[model samples]
Target: MKIKMKKFGVLLFAFLGLVSCSDDDDANVDPPFEGQSKSYDLTEVGESGVSGTATFDENEDGSVTITLDLDGTSEGVMHPAHIHFNSAAEGGEIALSLEPVDGDTGISETTVEMLDDKETEISFEDLMDFDGYINVHASADDLETLVAQTDIGGNALTGESVSYDLAEVDVEGVSGTATFYERENGETLVELDLEGTTEGNSHPAHIHMGSVEDAPGDIAITLTSVDGASGMSFTNVAMTDGTDDEEGTAVSYEDLIAYDGYINVHASADNLATLAAQGNIGANATEE
Candidate 1:
């Protein structure tokens, strides 16, 4: 019960950071979370570690760190592990990576800075917005483990009641992340972050159905542009069905949540169908 309570408190803190509390002063207010850094010892859930740390700093620059103590049970080799988006129930692709430890027992760390450019250049604000979590994948196989799960929380200087991060596409010749943080008054807004995008022809992007941790039922969302390796991106994706719409092209909101899907940015210059930086769209309503 205590562990559950503590985890709940963290989730609440994330909620608070996203939006302000209700106006009723007399209303019962949950105790303010005392920001602190804590460590978690992961276990062998499937083929990787099952634990890490979710640090909530009182200072605005604090970020949540996920450390994986991997088992080097495999013969001499550097196993691949990444922090992916989605639930363990429905698997998704890799979003970030933990410092890999080779051999038998190794420790990989993924410290997601709340307000800095660290591991994946992702912000705590953005991560918290998706009800996000950490996923550690098997080195050689497709099997994976949902290591950490929680929402973003905190009180920053922004005075805004929104939880999410939006950055520009900056990949010059490799992988990158393209996302839309929120929709303001109906005009859809998104950002294309290319930090390692390969230079070549544009590739197709999609907002497939379902959450990261669940199986996708269908492709519900589509993008209106393709990305280049020069950190260039475009938007204005049609989210609804239309007449003369290309087959398997456009989708809708109902289709968005029906199946577990996410924002898939495909790589064109290199691997034909390979993904670059993929993440979930939006989380749940956190405001009270």
Candidate 2:
């Protein structure tokens, strides 16, 4: 009886030891991660018809995982992609390279802990404030042809915008709208969309110093020439064109919304006197 009782006590001690070890192990284990994510729309470039969403996922380990899921991608073609260091309208050099998207699946995933230089550490938070844009090329050979693109981070549009009507001046039926879009970085994107522009002609557009009610003034800023074929022009405005006393002076979206200026679209570069469209913007804009 004494030996049996001693064995039973030894068994109880082992059981308690096992329970203590289990509790210690549970205490040392790390908890599951709860992180955040952001998604940006990737618009189709030109007529490529490929568009999708780019998602940046924050990992518990402080890395960023970028996933691109696209539609309308051609099978058997590997598309190259990169993060460029500026607004899409104002193109800049590549800041980071991503994995080539598999055309068959129309998907790509990359875990980025640092920039392309491999020295600049980029966390998920850093990417949210990055001044960059993403471009997915058609293929390795056709780098100039973009399949999908989006302005991310600071260059993304803030959804605050103002538009002014560009009425026909010298040309009949040549008129459109000039829109100023606010960027997240406080810059502005000036877009000119016109109608009835002659095909194969490029129209010079500019922001003059004064309103149209006043006499024509000197150019305050130069804008991208309107493409007659597409009847579109996109210019990223960060500063004055340095044409006046405030040459290369810094400008913001806030400044332009209250600016005393007018926009003019000429018939062509050579015929500045022949206006295709004209419009008063900012403080001079009519309530209508």
Candidate 3:
């Protein structure tokens, strides 16, 4: 009976030692991280049919993980991507290089804590206010061809926009609409979508100082030329054209919405007298 009791005492001591070790191990293990994430949609560029979402995940260590998931990529081909410094409408330099997306899986993941220069540290918080855009290229050989792109951070669209009709003036059937989209940074993106334009010609567009009913007015703002092939034009409006005496006047989305102006799409740069489309905007816009 004495021997049996001693053996039982030894077993109990071993069991207690095991429990203590288990507790120690549990204390040493790190806890799961709880962080936030942001996602931005990348739209298809030039009928590439490749579109995706760029997701930025904030890590507990103050780093960021960027993931790109695209659709319609060709199998076995890799696509290069990067973050550019300005709005997509206003092209800019590459700010950060990203991982190449695998065409077969159409996915890419990269962990970054710094810009391409390595000296500029960009945290997840900094990305929230970044004035930049993303571009995914077709490949290393064709970097100029963008498969997918988007305006992120401060350059993103605010979902508030105004559109004005562009009636045919000189041309019988050439007409379209001009839309002004508000940006998060208070700027505006002017997009012109037209139909019945000549296939190979380029049309000059502008916003004049007065209404179309008041005859012609001085050009208040110069916009991007409309491409006849695609019948689309994208312009970033930040200021008015600068003259010899003074600098360009600063313009914002708010100022544009209440300004007195008119839009004209000319047939060509040489033929300024001929109008492809004309419309009254701002205060002169007719309620319909």
Candidate 4:
């Protein structure tokens, strides 16, 4: 299921002109946190999917500034993307959508004012304390229609993690419920679980880029299903540096399979490991 991000006020009028300006002027003030936009081709990372660019900047409050470039895709394209709440080795959710780009590249741009000072001020409610990374998703042409994914920008909260649950069962003629949620001490923790509903069976059952999709680069590691485990289980996988796999043995929340993750158990009735229903584990999941 896709969740639409509420459109707010448009205040980035001089973004382009300010790209070259310095956030600080006293020469030694070191300037407030500042960042730049980075361009990349999804194909370079075994994504062979498409092209896009993401811009990152330091907000006046210490958080981050983000701009997305659809590289030429259109809005109504129905791709999913988001900012995972935590930065753990486990996984997360799509906090928002990647507004499609305009012109030939389908490049779209937008900015966010962040506040990296407090944690209780999470969510985009206050523009002063939500310190999290910005991730993008690629629209996959799958039956589940999960946007195959990839992280385009921002730093995933390394200290934050998530809770994974086989929240739902009854898909592709299968019935089982296995879920587990555990977070490492001092690690990022973003809560994500499948809601019980006709959301559809045979989704790429694995860790996606905080969003639903089968694109590229965003498949943070794949989850493995033990022989006949029913129900869910939780693991306090540790994540260091908000990247994919840096903690003891747990997978880094930022490690996309492209870096050494896996997705298995397809959704097909035949091999039962078709592209869909496949449990793709992003990076590595360290044991608690």
Best by lDDT: 2
Please, what are the lDDT tens digits per residue for candidate 4 over residues 1-288? 122222221234356446535543445476554443343232212232444555555445644445555543445553444555533223455444445334354545545442223233322233223323344444444223322233322322223433222312224443333223222223223222332223333333344443223433344433433222232222233432235555334543444322243233334335443432223233333334
| Residue-by-residue lDDT tens digits, candidate 3, 1-288 | 999999999999999999999999999999898888999999999999999899999998899999999999999899999999989988999999999999999999999999998899998889888999999999999998999999988888999999999999998899989899999889999999999987889999999998999968898899999999999999999998888998889999988888799999999999988999999888888879
TM-score of each: 0.31, 0.87, 0.87, 0.32
- Two-way lDDT contest, 2 vs 3, winner: 2
Candidate 1 per-residue lDDT, tens place, 143-225, comes to 34333332122111122222222222223244445444322222233445556545665766666566545734355655643
User: Where does model 1 exceed 4 Å of error?
Assistant: 1-175, 181-185, 215-217, 241-261, 269-272, 284-288
Give the range of the ten consecutive residues with the poorest summed lDDT in model 1.
151-160
lDDT of each: 0.45, 0.94, 0.93, 0.36
- What are the per-model numbers of colliding residue pairs? 35, 2, 0, 72
- The residue-by-residue lDDT of candidate 2 on 108-177, one tens digit each, is 9999999989899999888988999999999999998999999998888999999999999999999999
Per-residue error (Å), model 3, residue 168: 0.2
lDDT score of residue 220 within candidate 2: 86
lDDT of 3: 0.93
